[model samples]
Every structure is written in structure tokens, then in C-alpha cells.
Target: MLYGSTYPRDIFAELNRLQRELEQSFDIEPSIRGIGRGGFPALNVGSTPQSVELYAFAPGLDPAKIEVNLERGVLTIAGERTDQPGTPAQQATVHLNERFHGRFKRVVSLPDDVDPDGVSAVYQNGVLHISVRRQQAAQPRRIDVH
Candidate 1:
């Protein structure tokens, strides 16, 4: 068989096509812990007796651009990630863009025991850590008996 015309001229494009086909064949499911579509910025949530701790892993972001909100026992983290700089006149072709880009938001439902006024958030080293202190009345306390 003749070869020149049938061969793929763009190696990167061919590889990307193959990768997409393989992923489709495997029937993979998107997950929050992985770099799947719609699951930008993986999250880890945990609770302790005194407070609830939530950590969001999102790099290459401006701290000022992030918006954190807590209302009615719901916590929301939202921000935008700008795409990497490109070649002049948009001539660059991205071979692979596994990292998420653009606007993303993640919501979490908190327990009723959490105090609305006792929440704090800090973003450092590409990790946003949020702590919500539990209500004092809801915390465990030793009761005296006669």
C-alpha cells in the first residue's frame, strides 16, 4: 500500500486522537479526586469534634480572585483559571491540556452544628484551607453527677 498520503502529518494531533479514543473505549467515569472534566480543583473535607476542616487544591490562581462563601449550611468556592499564554496571533496548538481552565465552582453542605460566625479561610501554597468551628453548645462536655 502507498504510504505518504495516508500517514498522519501531525504527530501530536494523532496522539491526542488516540488518547481520546482509548478513554472512550474504557468508559471511564469522572471523579472529584481525579483530573476529570467538571471536577476542577479536587477537594478534601473532614470534621472534628471542635471544627470542620476543608481543603481545596487549586494551583496557579490569584488569591484575590477566589471567592469563598458560607450561607445556610452551604459552603461555596468559586474562581477562574486563565489559560496559559499562547503564540502570536493564536497560532499555537495545544497538544494536551489536562489541567482545568476557566471558571469553576465547588459546593459543600455543612452540618447544622457548625457556627455561622466562626468560619475562616486561608489560601497559601496553592491550597485553600477553610475551618468552621462547631457551636459551643453542640460540643461534647462532661456532665457532673451527684
Candidate 2:
């Protein structure tokens, strides 16, 4: 539905339609993670009365090599994953390779109510955790009258 006709039978078209539906049902920002939309690294976004939290899963990467930036409410995570060396220097080839390496950059559009000044991120156990407080004026409050 997103990019192909119903009878076109293109794999990418089906994927696009499925991705759109999933995003709509899950309230997910588009192209948030995985190789289909882009490549490497993945993230999850959540919200609370006080803040919005982002958890990016990136393993086998140096924390120092990773970079996170926010501009105009869009977050960008970029970094590279280095491959491990072979034990004997010449015996590490053949069958299958599944893990991803090299550099990747992902951008996520954030909610307008997020307070950029309060954003913070930390990489731990292969997950980059970010917390951005919601704008104080946007939070709900209760009022009472006598």
C-alpha cells in the first residue's frame, strides 16, 4: 500500500505496507531501526508524565566511537563497529557472516513537547539509554476548587 500495488507482488512493497501498519499500531516513529529502512543499530522510544526515554541497542561497539546529537527535536545516533581479529591471523574465513559492522546513522523525530535542555544519554551493556524530560508546561495538572 505504501509503494506498490496490491497485485504487484514486490517484496519491498509488502514490507513497506507491513511496516506502516506496525508503526501506526505501535505509535512508532518511522524508520526507527533495522536494515529494512536503513542499516545497523535499533532503538525504542517511550514516554511518561515527566519524560521521554530512548533505548538504542548497539552491541560490539566502542562507546567512545558512538555519537548522539539532537537538533530541532530530531535525534541522530552514529557509530562504527569494529570486527574482531582472527586467532592465528589467517584462519577466519568461509561459511556465514551475520553480524553487521562499519558505520551507521539513524535519525529519530521526537515529540514537540520534549525539553531538549534536559536530555541525557549513557551507553551501558550495549544499550544507549537516553532520557529527555517533557516540557513542564505540556504536562497535565489537576485543579481543585472549594
Candidate 3:
């Protein structure tokens, strides 16, 4: 129960708890695509005066499978990561698997100054690096005071 004025009344809280219990009791099966958490590639995004750069740390993914798109002030990366090669029977117990797998799509809203046509992408050493240059007019200009 939350403290302060934010907490709901005791009766309301009890009713909410009962609702959750009833939902769990139903035990509805989940869809195949909704079975687990979808993949979300970790990224390091930064920008300079001239360009915006984004680097996604995605190992074990083929560079050819990756796709990047910039449109309407949005940058999107969508792709699928193939499964590891090996006989499933040969593998014993699994432990500590934190890496993301399956389909991944990340959309980032770009600044108004970013030039969509000037976007470039490079995949190397399991890292996807993207650079988008700023428009000529969008760059800072120095003015002379006479």
C-alpha cells in the first residue's frame, strides 16, 4: 500500500487485489509472438554540431540482416537475430543469458536539423554505427557586427 494521499481507500485496494487474483486464476495462454519480451538493441546515441551518431551493440547478428531507415524526423532500426548454431540436445543447462534475440525495432525521434538523406550506417565488430549530418542551414553561423 502506498503512503500519503496517493494511496486509494482500503476497500478499493482490497477490490483491486481481488481483481488481480481473479485474472491470474483464469490463466489465459499467451500468443507465440507474445511469449517473451521482445528484443530491444542497446544503443549509444550522441550528436555533434555537424552530425548525429548512434551506435547499437548487437553481437552475433549478420551485418547484412540489419536495416536502417530515417523518415519524417524518425530513425528506425529493424532486424532479426539468428539463433546460435549447435545441436539443442548437446547443450546442457543454460545460465546467464542476458543478450537480446529475435526481432528488434528501435525508433528514435530526430532533431529538426537532421538531414534524412545524409544518413549513413556501418556495421563492424558487432556494432551498428549510424551518422546523420545536419542541414547546411541548420548549422550555427557566425554574424559580424559592424
Candidate 1 per-residue C-alpha lDDT over 118-143 given as tens digits, one digit per residue, 9 for 90 to 100: 99999999999999999977458899
What TM-score, computed on C-alpha atoms, does each candidate reach? 0.65, 0.66, 0.64
lDDT of 2 at 104: 63
The candidate that achieves the highest lDDT relative to the unseen native structure:
1
lDDT of 3 at 97: 34
Clashing pairs in 3: none
Per-model lDDT: 0.73, 0.72, 0.68
Per-residue alpha-carbon lDDT of candidate 2 for residues 17-100, written as tens digits (9 for 90 to 100): 566457546755546444344235767879998898988888878999998888899988887776567732237543433355
Clashing pairs in 2: none
**Selected candidate, larger lDDT, 1 vs 2:** 1
Off by over 4 Å in 2: 1-38, 87-90, 138-146
Q: What RMSD does each model have against the real structure?
A: 9.3, 10.8, 11.2
Candidate 1 achieves a global lDDT of 0.73
